[model samples]
Target: MNGAVVEARNLTKRYRDVLALDDVSIRLSADRIYGLLGRNGAGKTTLMSVLTAQAFATSGDALVFGEEAYENDRVLSRVCFIRESQKYPDDFTAFHAFKAARLLFRNWDQAFAERLIGDFGLPVKRRIKKLSRGQLSAVGVIIGLASRAELTFFDEPYLGLDAVARQLFYDRLLEDFTDSPRTVVLSSHLIDEVANLLDHVIVIDQGRILIDAESDALRGSAATVVGPAPKVNEFVTGMKVLHREALGPLASVTVDETLSAAQRTGAARLGLEVAPVSLQQLVIRKTLINHPSRRVPGGDAELDSMEATR
Candidate 1:
């Protein structure tokens, strides 16, 4: 198989007057974890749908394993997409769903699926329709993990899950990833929660890719400095200030530009406190500040970011 697992070439999608995606192109490799991030209506969902063959693009092409993904059995069989609101027949119990999954997925691990079901405290006989939102999410998680597909996408898989349950999911995912590496794309609103799990991140805004880089590199790309208003203002005068906050004499400003050795020394000399910006905060500022004219479809921008990526 080719090293490039997912490839999009000038991908575009439209819904009536709205351009859901706009000439977006990206290349994702295998055996790595990717974070698909963007505000609501930024085309994150449209892009993933096109790549996974769940939905067609209005223009351009998407390839999975070097083959057209749309209705292509060769490519589709190796992929699994777990939607946030995954649907199961009203009468279908978790046990029945797993049985179906076992028949469909060549790599399905029944033992693993059973263990996950126990860990999540999901009742085998309970019909899917009777499960709570959190339990419903757990079913999707179990299927996605146990399917063992070479390419798996988890689109906001932890909705309504408590902190403890969410942590368990992350722990299991990381452990399994270490044992058997595959391409895993996670779309989540809890940026800080999954920040450490991602090797790479792709951020989209207004249907355009705004940032695509290694997670570590992105973390180091921006810095925030705080000090007296005048000094901070002087220090950030020519830099790309992404956001700024002021409380009387104290001022804190986040800059998009990386700091040089000379700049670091200058900040120290000026008695300015420099700190790193979290992925979540950076994304919020980027999407909200840069595109204020566009309100995220969902009231919650973070939730939209996670779901859109799915």
Candidate 2:
């Protein structure tokens, strides 16, 4: 929160028949990890591209390090952008990639890179084309971590890595970040996995910024209460309900507001089960509420319609 490392004001991007980004404004502070979350085609990649100077926005401005990022060596050198599908020369190997990164990034650490190579069990001699998808992803993850850039953007860095490898990446990232605090913006579909790693969260939906808030503030912001339909309905009567469903006589309702200690006790008295909503659940609820077309066959819309009749 000391100063904004990245800032976009009323940003908009359109591609002929498609509107990729729409009037989005956001700011990223230094020395913090931000979770840039959204479903596929939600404009996450488009926004990152615009900010990194890889893609031009049809309208508005994208500023990095207090200046436009395009063609600015001073700015770009201090930043690292790792894409989900990073391509390399067919003849090149992980060794060549690391060697090139060392020269390009001023803050690149060879020792750190070597350690990460070992940690990921990456084969340096194997040609880039000969490596598996998981191994290729490992190369990118290693570079992103070892680059030690002042600002880093990891757009789905854990693409083909298995569960253990993904967790390893998270562990290594958190450990390294704690030692050398820098700004990191991670865009991943696995919300719950990275939820704890984020200091701030930004959720995009349909080219719009649906959520931009401190991560801690979002915890306990919503709760799910389960009980008989009548009791559940009465308990959530004056609250902002994000989602609700009925299974025969039992109704489970998710309210957007937090519950106090007394309120929790009151729910228990009514035999209502109160559960904390995870980050994933909250994001899903919000996204579905915003985009009706993206819902499943028997999703929120149908459930709400059924509730209306009751």
Candidate 3:
């Protein structure tokens, strides 16, 4: 929990002709909540599986706590991976699952688990198969929150949950995290919802790293300027523009660099409005990641690429 809680070197997973992870290398910091974001089939789950040793990599290595995760009791016992669709045995009830959690995880908090169970309104005596989808998701969320592992990976663990329930999960997570700081990673397509929860972000696209940076830094890296076309052009000169929209004499452009105070003043003088882009829009405009990129750019991220790479 001091240094890198998880590290991968040239990690790759190939299922026949399909490439799941393409020589991806990353280091997860200790005691930080990281958002592992990407589109579907972007290898988010693949990366998690490799790191947690739930599945073997075709090539390269994954280390948990500076040691290989595969078959290492010392490492595995301290890690918890709750999948989006968790499967329990036919006979396993929610109570049975809790019992299993208590046996497997050394840091399992029964009282905390009970609280989460009540918060989620899970039926403890009912069979896992009999629970509704939201309740099923709650089972995973409950285990994940209560397990309190040194390294915990939640792979979209809130499917089938209503907006209110999802908000509850987020509130509970942040509240509990304040008391027990640990290495946590959340993989989700609900980017904006978890934007505030992330300390850092790592976006994967087509089995490759797209963007890896601190959340605040990432949020501050882009701005949208709207005004007369000429003034906008003059203000954004030499800056990277990710997207642009124009109507008659007016224009609005999304730029990769955060506006300096002087730049803001200049924009104000030019009658241009500079606005911060939302994390969702930032990711979308910055990467254009949702469309057409079969191969990952094998290079370091730069402001210039915020538009060009798309």
TM-score of 3: 0.92
For model 3, residues 1-310, the per-residue Cα lDDT tens digits are: 3598888999999989999999999999888999998888989999998898988999998888889888999999999999988889999999999999999999999999999988988899999999999999999999999999989999998899999999999999999899999989999889999999999999888798888899999887999999998888877777877778888998888888988899889899999999889888887765572345522364323434443332
Cα deviation in Å at residue 225, candidate 1? 0.8
TM-score of each model, in listed order: 0.92, 0.94, 0.92
lDDT of each: 0.86, 0.92, 0.88
- After TM-score superposition, the amount by which residue 41's alpha carbon in candidate 2 deviates from its true location, in angstroms, is 0.7
After superposition, the stretches of candidate 3 with alpha carbons farther than 4 Å from their true spots are 289-310
Write candidate 1's Cα lDDT for 14-38 as tens digits: 8889888889999999999999998
Clashing pairs in 2: none
What is candidate 2's CA lDDT for residue 133? 93
Candidate 3 C-alpha error for residue 248, in Å: 4.0
Over 4 Å off in model 1, which ranges?
292-310
Candidate 2: residue 183 Cα off by (Å) = 0.4
RMSD of each: 6.5, 2.9, 3.3
Per-residue C-alpha lDDT of model 2 across residues 58-101, encoded as one tens digit per residue? 99998899999999999999999998888898899999999999
Top-lDDT structure, candidate number: 2
Who is ahead in TM-score, 2 or 3?
2
